[model samples]
Every structure is written in C-alpha cells, then in structure tokens.
Target: MIVKHGSTTFLKVIIFLTGIAVLALCVWLPEIAIRDARVHPDTAFFLIPFLLCAYGFCIAFSVALYQAYKLLTYIEKNNAFSELSLKSLKIIKKCAFTVIFLILLGIVSLRVLAKVTGGDDAAGPISLCLMGILATSIITAIVDALQKPLKNILELKPEND
Candidate 1:
C-alpha cells in the first residue's frame, strides 16, 4: 500500500511536469516555425496554416492533460472507479481523437502543399504528423478500453450502495 501510494505520487509529479512541458512546447513551436519560414521563404506559405492547426491541437492536448491530472487526483482520493473518473477518461478519449483527426488533416494539407510546391521538404513534417496520429490513436484506444471496466464499476456501485 505504501509503495502504491508512492508510485501514484511519482506519477502525479511526472504528469504535472509533462503538462508544463506541453505548454512550453506549444509556445515555442510557433516561434521556431516562424524563424524557419523566414530562413526558408519557400515554405512560408504552408507554415501559416500549419502553425494554426498546431495551436488548435495544442489546446486539445492541454485539455487532455488536465483531464489526466483530474483522473490522477481521483485515484489518489480512492475514487478511481467513480463517475468523475469515467467522465475524465471520456474527455481524454475525445481529446485524443480530436488530436488524431487534426493530425490527419495536417497530413492531407502537407501532401497537397508538397504537390503544389514540387518539393520534398514536407516529407519530414508529414512523417511527424503520421506518428502523432498513431500515438494519439493508441492513447484514445487505451482510454476507451479503460472506460468499459470503469463504466461497469460505476453501474454496480449504486446497487451495492
């Protein structure tokens, strides 16, 4: 029980740090993108829309991280199986799916830009977007899987009460 408690605390700290890092990245990415665009004028046309999409996804990711923090709090309070936890998981799943969808859209945009520009520079960001989609899809699936058992527990709890 003590070890479990310690691990939860550690995880919460890690999550907190991760949330901060995500925020920092969200702020930093636009500046970097702008600088790169200035250095490479040819890509500036697509960079504007990419930065906009990136900012939108950043907001979604931040919300998902906040939900994870709330879920962690529920676990620490011995309410991991409660409706609140389930709701958090549901929100997190939606956020992950939103991210996946946004990345897929970005992939299509990059493809179009590459064809129009007749350049291979978009390949790098396209690969990154594909990986992002895959990662977010997995996160969404895991959260969905968690929701099932949590839903069962939440349903049974009232009868037991």
Candidate 2:
C-alpha cells in the first residue's frame, strides 16, 4: 500500500544520505591527515598505517551500505524474503565483521606504535576503536539473527507454495 512504499522510500533516502556522508568522510579524513602530517612531520609515520586501516574500514562500510540499499530494494519489490535479499544481508554481515576486524587490528598497531614511541597517551583513540568494534559487532549479530529466521522461512516457503 501507500504506507509500505512510503516507508521504503524513506529508508532509501536515509541510505542515500548515509552513503553521501561516508563519501564526505572518506574525502575529508585524508586531507586532515595530510594537514596534520605537514604540521607535525614526526607523526607522519603513524598516519600512513592508520590511514590505510581507515580506508579499509571505509571500503567495508560502503559495501555494507550498498548491500543494505539493495536489501531495501528487494523489500520494495516484494522480494524481501527471497535469495537475493538473503545474500544482501549476508554481505552486510560480512562487512560488519570486516569492520570489526580492521578496527581491532588498527587498535593493536596503534598500541604497538605508542609503545615504540615511549608510550604516548593513546587511551582516547583506543577507547574510540573499542566503541567502533562494539557497534560493528552488534550490527553483525543483528544481521546474523535475522539471517537464521530468513533461512528458515525460505526453506518453508517452497513447501507452502
């Protein structure tokens, strides 16, 4: 009905906006890093590895967003419970896991770098990374929970039809 279409449209808009926001962040983060490197040349060494990890996170996030958008499309098309929808959810879940892994690796590297440099105060950044990991893990768990019921429904669908 009208309500269903409206809800999907709103979700699609939100997804589009999220993609744009991420794109902006992707562009802005490097500029900030380069600027900081220029101001504090010694910190430049740390920036490269951190930036690489950040870019990896961005890529995974973008993939998850795209998959979510596709999932919304599937729902709009009355195929919410279909194989394509399931695949999209699976991809999103994997992307969440990737993000969590990247954040953890980045945190470890940051800790090692801090130690090598006589232990700079890295508690703030580490805390942020922990939060990011927690959020990604929750997303992954939610997607996983959804996947099981979806798979069961898919299995039962054929029998019903």
Candidate 3:
C-alpha cells in the first residue's frame, strides 16, 4: 500500500512539472516569435501564420495534458483499468495525432519558405518540427499500447464481478 501510494505521488509530481513547463513554453514561444518578427524583416511575412499554428499546437497540447491529469487522478483512485482511463488515452491519442499533423504541415511550409528565399535559414525550425513529430508520434504509440491492456482489464472486471 505504501509503495503504491508513493508511486502515485511521484507520478503526480511529474505530471505537475510537465504541465508547468508546457504552459511556460506556450507563453514564451509567442514572445520570442514576435521579437524575431520585429528584428528580422524577412520573417515578418510569416509571423501571423507561425503564431496561428503555434496557438493551435498549444491548444492540442493543453488538452492532452488535461487528459493526462485526469488519467493520473483515476490511477490514484485505483481505477486505472476502468473505461474512463481508456477514454482518456483515446483523447490523448487524438491530440497527439493532431500535433503530428500540424507539425508536418509546418515542416512543408518551412521548406517552401526556405526554397523561395534561397536560403537554409528555415532549416533549424524544420528540424525542430521534425523532432516534435517524432516525439508526439512516440507518445501516441505508447498511449495506444496502454489502451490495449486497460481494455483487457476492463473486460475482465465485468466478468470477475
């Protein structure tokens, strides 16, 4: 009992820290983007579009994080194998897919911008977007894998009861 409670506490702390960092990134990204637009005349044209995509990504991220928080709460309450846990995982998967799609779109746009400008300045952001895609895809896969076991447990629950 003690070990289980301790683990839950640890997971809660991790979730809280992750949520704080993501929220901070949400706030910081736009400030730096606006500053860059002011400093670099060439990038000014892309500022609004970039900001809009960033906002979209942030929204998806926040929703996923909220789902994670709920999932964690369910686990703490010893309901990790319940239908609600599976539902939360499904929502997280959808959010990850949305993030992946958005990042891929951004990558294409960045490539086009680079080609038109005849420079590789967009390379850095393209690389970042690629990394984001990789990370979110992995998260999506893991959440998807988690759902299978939860579903199995849920199936057994009704039979056992």
- Each model's lDDT comes to 0.85, 0.89, 0.84
Clashing pairs in 2: none
lDDT by residue (51-139, candidate 3, tens digit) is 77777888898889889988888887877777899999999999999998888878877887788778668878888888988899889
TM-score: which candidate is best? 2
What are the per-residue Cα lDDT tens digits for candidate 1 across 22-118? 8898879978997988897976888878887888888898899889989888887787878899999999998998888888889988888878878
Error of 1 at 143 (Å): 0.8
By summed lDDT, the worst window of 10 consecutive residues in model 1 runs over 1-10
Q: Cα deviation in Å at residue 51, candidate 1?
A: 1.3
TM-scores for every predicted model: 0.89, 0.91, 0.86
Please provide, for model 2 over 1-161, each residue's C-alpha lDDT reduced to its tens digit, 9 standing for 90 to 100. 22388888898899899999989999999899989889878768989888988899899999999999899888888888889989999999989988998999899998987887785888999999999888888888899999999999999999998
| The candidate that achieves the highest lDDT relative to the unseen native structure | 2
Misplaced by over 4 Å in model 1 are 1-3
How much is the lDDT of residue 148 in candidate 1? 98
In model 3, the worst 10-residue window by lDDT is 1-10
